[model samples]
Target: MGRLQRLSSNACQRLARRAAPQPIIRRRVTYQVAGRDFLVISGYEPDGQRIFYLKKLVRPSLQAGFEFVYPANRRERYDRDVEAISRSLSLVDP
Candidate 1:
């Protein structure tokens, strides 16, 4: 499968695993950053916490990403930092 397809499939698998414990409120979003497209899966818990799993295919053979877990009630405080970190993603030669 292609990168985007694979990423989506993996994200769905992850969501299933997470859902086994409790129903997780989540959204699958796409963002354009540093001239690349990123797939982000954000999951929210009933207890006022959240998790973000961001991933992008940096190259045909590589993937790049990051994750963040924070209190949903304090999202305003974490939004800027999350945006900064997401914007910092870059394609590097290996």
Candidate 2:
């Protein structure tokens, strides 16, 4: 199995362990800093690929919001790159 397959397998095991209580659950954690929202989420694709993402949300409003997602197995590198990109972000009017 490839890395993605292995990750999905592990997630399935963890999900099964939690099935005794509810069977299915999805969880996401988010926070805001410097007017930017950050989130961590876990999920699986239709092909059974385990997907993990660190997202940065910008221009939050009642109308709409823009977001960027970074997915890398190395958590530290992902975090660092996202932070740097977030710091350099600037919005321009259409």
Candidate 3:
């Protein structure tokens, strides 16, 4: 049993070493919203999947976070739509 466990562990380690690591490319930008600044972080994975993260600079605790994942093949459309949404973002006072 001990020999079997050792062999299994070695096999798992070998497989992990053989797998290619995904690279993360990210960009940080600040946008003006309602006269306040907000931080936006956007990035892409090695598979071309896109991710977007936004947070309020002034009051991060009050910010609601969300995540949207897009298929790798739709990178172009995702980029276009994210750009449009960023340009149209605004904060309204209650």
Candidate 4:
């Protein structure tokens, strides 16, 4: 399961300090292509409702986050598909 990324260095320290008792849930899968690492993560509620998807380049802080859901049983395949999609992405000019 994935854990929340620290929004900032101080947020990390505050999280480590344990202010909230609610259970946070997430799942993460990471893959590397070329020399960069990318993360695929899903956040959910305790009752199993999805909240968002996050894909980020681990080193450069490039990221995109949004709501998306897939059947729990098919996540592995979908992650691979996402990897393929991500791998093909490019910054384009109009």
Candidate 5:
């Protein structure tokens, strides 16, 4: 799967309350997970590869946020995201 599995109902409700759309930039979304804030981003290359970047954004909502960032040079970010999803969801190993 290219994206994380659909969240559970309770999680969905929380996320709906937390999500805030912002301009595309170093950060793509603001969402709450387990009552904590997270910054998530994804990118695609011309070759049709996809990757995600996740980082915790803990703060007073204004004093702190991630600085300019992009996918790490390492190619395994996609692999890790995929593997983690499968593992946590009890799906077969990819």
Candidate 6:
């Protein structure tokens, strides 16, 4: 929940587990695009399955795509891009 900090290759692999209770994030996928880094974390609970994704868009040219599912009973409710990145990175709206 804290800012994910700058993660190394090993750190990214380590996050691929259940670390919290709410939202119950259980899986993480990480890769690089252009020059920046991206990460996706998905999980499921009794209510439904949710996916929270994060991307560090270091390169402004790459297309950004991510999704944030919060206790989502339906997948279509959440946006599939910037909002997802913000949610995963804990970015707050001003």
Give the number of the best model, judged by TM-score. Answer: 1
- Candidate 4 on 4-94: residue-level lDDT in tens? 6649888877887796675755454332233355555555434453333455544454443333555556667676765566666553333
Ranking 4 against 5 by lDDT, winner: 4
Better model by TM-score: candidate 2 vs candidate 4:
4
lDDT of 3 by residue, 1-94 (tens): 3454445888888888779685665443222234355665555544444444443333434543334456647767876776666566655544
Q: Write the per-residue lDDT of candidate 5 for residues 52-91, one digit (tens) a residue.
A: 4343344453323232223446556545654464334321
What does the lDDT come to for candidate 5?
0.44
What would the per-residue lDDT of candidate 6 be over residues 1-94, giving only the tens digit for each residue? 7675788888776776545444653454432234334444455444345544444433334445444445445546654553544655532333
TM accuracy, model 1: 0.52
TM-score per prediction, in order, is: 0.52, 0.33, 0.42, 0.35, 0.23, 0.28
The number of clashing residue pairs in each candidate reads: 0, 0, 0, 0, 0, 0
Instruction: For model 5, give the 10-residue run with minimal summed lDDT.
Output: 61-70
Worst ten in a row by lDDT for model 4: 26-35
Higher-TM-score candidate of 1 and 6: 1
How does residue 30 of candidate 1 score in lDDT?
Answer: 31
Clashes of 3: 0
Alpha-carbon runs more than 4 Å astray in model 1:
1-37, 46-48, 51-53
Each prediction's Cα lDDT score? 0.65, 0.47, 0.53, 0.53, 0.44, 0.48
Candidate with better lDDT, 4 vs 6: 4
Q: Model 1 Cα RMSD, Å?
A: 15.1
The local distance difference test score of model 4 is 0.53
lDDT of 2 at 18: 80
